[model samples]
Target chain A: MTGIEPLAVAAAGLMGIGLYGFCLCRHAVRRLLSINLFGNGVFLALILIARRLPDGPDPVPHAMVLTGIVIAVSATAFGLALVRRQARTRGDDET
Target chain B: MTALDSLLALLLLLLAARCVSARSLLQAIVAFIVLGLLLALSWVRLEAPDLALAEAAIGAGLLGVLLLGTWRSLPLGHGNERIPLPWQGLRPALITTGCTVLAVLLTVALHQHPEQAAMSGLAALDQLDAAGVDQPVTAVLLNFRAYDTLLEMGVLLMALIGTLMLDSPLPRDTELPARTMLPATLAQLFLPLILLIGLYLVWAGAYSPGGAFQGGAVLAGAGVLLILTGFGEGDGRDGWVLRALLAGGALVFTLAGLLLIPVTGAFMAYPQGLVTPIMVLIEFSLALSIALSLLLLYTGTPGLRRRGER
Candidate 1:
């Protein structure tokens, strides 16, 4: 097998780990981390697959992964905001 | 080449597993950040320097800062658990078994499948001259598949707005203690240099493996440094300038696409010779917006006033 296959497999392993963590993790922050990990796996797969080109790696997936990284951060920020507010509310209610 | 690839693949897997399985949240987050850096390295290995820049900057740098900030904001004891999977005895076993089977099957299929497909950017690259950018990724992002970039800017803007609306972010200025973490001397020395590099990255983007996102992330790192050092004027609440900066990318891309639609005969298509300047303008605005938007996300506030300011 070529070098690319191992990277792909690692990425796939990350996806499985993310899936397990996302479902099982008790902490909201951990869940978010898992989600981001899963997203990273998908992005990595897209990128590694782009290596099949001859002239150079394909630019399309590179661009898409760039966009994906930015979008992933945005989603993470939003989710963190939601989690922060929820945690605050929960703290307040307990008091 | 194969050795390096194998090493990266192994390191990524191990770091990722540690990130997922670390006993504490802090360790997990640290591991995740390291994983991001390693992933950036893998992106480089894949021969995409543009992505490497972005992954290292936005993915590892900016995102790491944000996650750490989030960790700080959460109430104590909430994020510290090693929390097990929600599954009881049989369920965990079932999941492991299922995942292993699927993974094995997929790996086999991937090995057997032929590599022929129509997914390469070669066809689009043949038209790169018309795309108005010298870098293939930039050409693809700013011209060929520009709609995605435009909408991504929209997503960023929405994120900022949503974060602002969530709650009062950051401790009230008066409540914030002076000298949070980084020393003043360090910030004074490094901030300017960071900003210079950020600008250089943006400028180099046209013909090189740098661009708006990577440059924006570098600038956001600068902003994060300023905020941590307690000297930043990130307060965006009333500053129309800040508001404008936050919205600039989407506004520029949409307006350019709309106003030129009739002239260019297609939305976002630059005219015969105007593509260069237009793309530059769009990218400049986009970078600035991304920087500000990311900083806002990091601070989780619509505005940040100086501690002593009224």
Candidate 2:
């Protein structure tokens, strides 16, 4: 173990806030936003951990994070579509 | 540098809190977008520029557009009602306490930095020449861990398919709304430049932070700009060409990996003499598919058409 990094502390804070938001927010879209915030925290944590290596940042984790971002974005987009469908089904399509 | 990192860390926490606690969805959306950009900055500080690029493009940029569009499509006051806590009385407090405990545990767990943990990165770097890519991250993605990337493309495709099943296209606009000259002019001026940059990014990924994901997201942004500016619009009719392009990346990736097994005696291992060209082919095809899939997801449609086309 080494001295705690500030970014690690921030990552924890993000995860906490995201979890709180996800639980408290009633709107499906807001909940999605919260989940994404949580995902961001996890990504940040991984990136920070990758920095722990002596010579350079770990490319394996970097590649993983890249893949994770794409997956997150795609999943979020799909979730958004579902939200739109739900609203339309509820007769709230007044856009 | 430590001070700057501390400031960024503080900013990230504050922004995430604000994003979650804002009264209005619009405010929360804006806060989330800013948080995403700040996260990208933090990645750069952490020495992961490839992740930073992907985050900035897909995580912040494209996701922002999708969020805003969804917000616009939802009826006014539809989801803006009172946001009560998940439960009454002590449950909210209990949840908050639980989250805090979880955070603490995660932080404590993350502090351990064993010297042996560096072996994977060191091994990747040691064999970078044999991997056929200059950038270690690219090598890890397109070569060393090509299987993971291949399956990721499948996940992306499946997501697109699921979205399409919803049968709800985003509000289609055949032309730009009145009095929006600036967006139209900007799209016209920037479309070519954006296209060029996106392609350049794909080529540069062989030796840089840019790659299929980032490059594809940028190209998707270009498509979004066109759609928003009335140059192109989502069409309900499905076309073979669009379908092929949408599935091209995963198709090429699978074929490349499978076809190479006989030549290299292992799945996804490129022949020594043809590694670069094969990677370039796989990279470009993947970019094309990713870009089209994302664009379609944004459109919520099966096809896209020029504004005036039948």
Candidate 3:
């Protein structure tokens, strides 16, 4: 209700939801989605936590998240490519 | 928190949940794109404009197209098909419970981490002048921890290589979409502006809320739009030039680092007086490489030649 609890709570909730979805999803593409959700959740937590500190904010974590975002997308693209290859080779629908 | 923050947070949570739980894959994919946009807004609220820009351009724009394109390439009706529900048992319930508990515990712990200890990154901000970039994040990324940035570029190249290795060639759907006058006209007008903006973002990164990642994403978005609208086409052929752009960032950074060793003693030290020019060169190459890699990745091909009879 006060300070930055709401933001933190939202981040924590997203993380939990993403983790739950990661566990529940059966499809590779869906799993990639879940994992990215989880990553954004962590990014949200990190950026906000950096703000909570007395000093203005931390550039290191900010930089990390920035780097992480790009890397996450690249990895996602690659994973999707793999999934497509598997589907082609197996001659079956994605599970 | 202001009402706006609360509202944004609620919207984000809802979209995230929707993306995760939607009954259809297409529905989930759409929700994911919206979630990404909302995340950009959230980043803005958190006072991180750089992040907001990157999230909007890369997270929402490029990634959204990537997801939808993948879905389109998949067999029709795959998105609508209903697969079996979560693992048929107690595992689902247990995972939900476990994650929930973990979340609660971490939230409680977040309150206890010492505030001043988090000052190290901010403290490093004091030494930003030597980095030759006015932006603190830029300094950290390009100077203080250039090694990490170099490795990050390597990760991107690795991903590109991995995608290429597992590349599944599209079924020769070379037919361009019927060219509509309005969108085509608009794209012709917009492409130049987007290209200008991407370059501007990279240039402004030294002193403001823009950088190579954000700029490259914007450039890639432009390329994606071009491919999607049939204003441009992807030849999907391999060549040395495409490979160079794909590996250029990592190669330039690594080679520069090694070359500087005898002069600066430290691996990634930008040397003493030549920091500015070197940083500029590195940023330019990195931006160029990132743009090409992202664009190629979206094209879902190892190489992209502008569409032609060749």
Q: What tens-digit string does per-residue lDDT give for candidate 3 at A23-69?
A: 77777778888888888888888788667645556788889889999
- Tens digits of per-residue lDDT, candidate 1, B102-134, equal 656655554554557435488767888888888
- For the predicted complex of model 3, DockQ is 0.60
List, residue by residue over B12-57, the lDDT tens digit for candidate 3: 7888788778878888889888988888888877878898899888
Estimate, for each residue in A1-95, the C-alpha lDDT of model 2 and write its tens digit: 45778889888888888898888888998999999999998899888878867788888888888899889999999999999999888875444
Per residue, candidate 2 scores C-alpha lDDT tens digits across B5-36 of: 89999999889878887888888888999999
- Cα lDDT, model 3, residue B283: 87
Interface RMSD of 3: 1.9
The candidate maximizing TM-score is: 2
What DockQ does each listed candidate score? 0.67, 0.75, 0.60
What is the clash count for each candidate, in the order shown? 3, 0, 0
lDDT measured at residue B137 in model 3 versus the true structure, 0 to 100:
82
In order, the Cα lDDT scores of the candidates are 0.81, 0.87, 0.79
The docking category that best describes candidate 2 is: medium
Better of 1 and 2 by TM-score: 2
Give the 10-residue window scoring lowest on summed lDDT in candidate 3 chain A: A1-10
Which ranges of candidate 1 are over 4 A from the true structure? A1-4, B83-88, B109-120, B168-182, B233-236
